[model samples]
Target: MDDLFDDILNLEEQYYKEGYDEGYKDGAEAGRIEGRSVGMKTGFEKFLEAGRLQGKAIVWQSRLPSQQESSTSAGNSQQETVQTVPSPTSQDGKDSEPRRLPPLSSNPRLEKNITMLYGILEPGTLSTKNDDESVNDFDSRLKGAQSRVKMIERAIGEGAGDKGSANRNRQQAQKNENIEDIGRIPQRTDVVMGTV
Candidate 1:
């Protein structure tokens, strides 16, 4: 009986270690897969965001020529001022050029996108963050994106409603125009009654 008890105890210990090892391996594999999937998803989102920002930049670039022309016109006025009066001197006693205020940037969405793009493009910026921290960051970004999308949807809906009303108004105007044209036609006042 003593020998049997000792054998049972040894068997129990062996099985327990085997079970722990297997569980640990399985958990590690699952963790690795989860981490990889999350990383890929985050990377793809960043890629899309970068592309969006690039598109915005392109739009801004296309508007640059117009902006420059306006600025040139403004510059002519500035040149008149320069000729009449010297700009205020700084503490260093050098002739300081007049500061030209930048053009008013009206698009908040574009600004935000550019700011986010800068953050994304910063060098080695995300290397120190761990997986859990990254997951939290992703959650925050997703929430912000969702809100932006909702706002866009609302704007689109309102725009569609406005277009529908405009279409109806246009159709009504056309109908009125047709009626006016019919009323302007000449009526026959002299009908011949000699034919049977």
Candidate 2:
């Protein structure tokens, strides 16, 4: 019958469509794998760029003391002389030097090995030599750090409170279990359904 033949054609088309969809899904998954690899490469590139900048900044800082010393001897502005570092010239001639300022000495080790510690931390801001100019961005960052410390302290306090509450809850739950008559418990159901 013609009806039977149409049904067979319909079934064949359905199977073909299913196979197409499965192939599409497989291709999409393969595309996703390639996308993930590209994303990872991009992330790694960004990390490397940040690290390079940090290194440049550190190098700039290391050379600050000599500049400071020169300025002091010359009776010139101390901060001013330190600001005039030459262009960075790496071994590769790809200069990353004087352009970048050293990160500051926030480390505890500054008391121990002054030279070694100074080698690590450099003045990030060239303009931040005096308390006047240094007070701008440095002030904000210091405030931010202070706020972060407070937040951490608050979090620790909150965590302790939550632990105490959870212990109380657990004890209550255990008490309920102990007091309940488990052997002769009755089965009950509450149903609220409109559509049957």
Task: List per-prediction Cα lDDT, in the order shown.
Answer: 0.57, 0.50
lDDT of 1 by residue, 1-196 (tens): 3676787779988999999999999999999999989978877776566456445344443334455567678878877655333356555546566554343344566445534543443335434355778756655654555454344324334322466777988898887686568668676668667754
State the local distance difference test value for candidate 1. 0.57
Error of 1 at 82 (Å): 35
Query: After superposing candidate 1, which stretches have Cα over 4 Å from the reference?
Result: 9-13, 64-196
Model 2: CA > 4 A from native: 66-196
Count of steric clashes across candidates, in order: 0, 8
Task: Locate the minimum summed-lDDT window of 10 residues in model 1.
Answer: 152-161
Leading candidate by TM-score:
1
Taking all chains together, the TM-score of candidate 1 against the true structure is 0.36
Per-residue lDDT tens digits for candidate 2, residues 25-46, read 9999999999889867864664
Per-candidate TM-score against the hidden true structure: 0.36, 0.32
User: Per-residue error at 135 for model 1, in Å?
Assistant: 7.9
Task: Tell me the lDDT of candidate 2.
Answer: 0.50
Instruction: Give residue 7's error in model 1 in angstroms.
Output: 2.5
Clashing pairs in 1: none
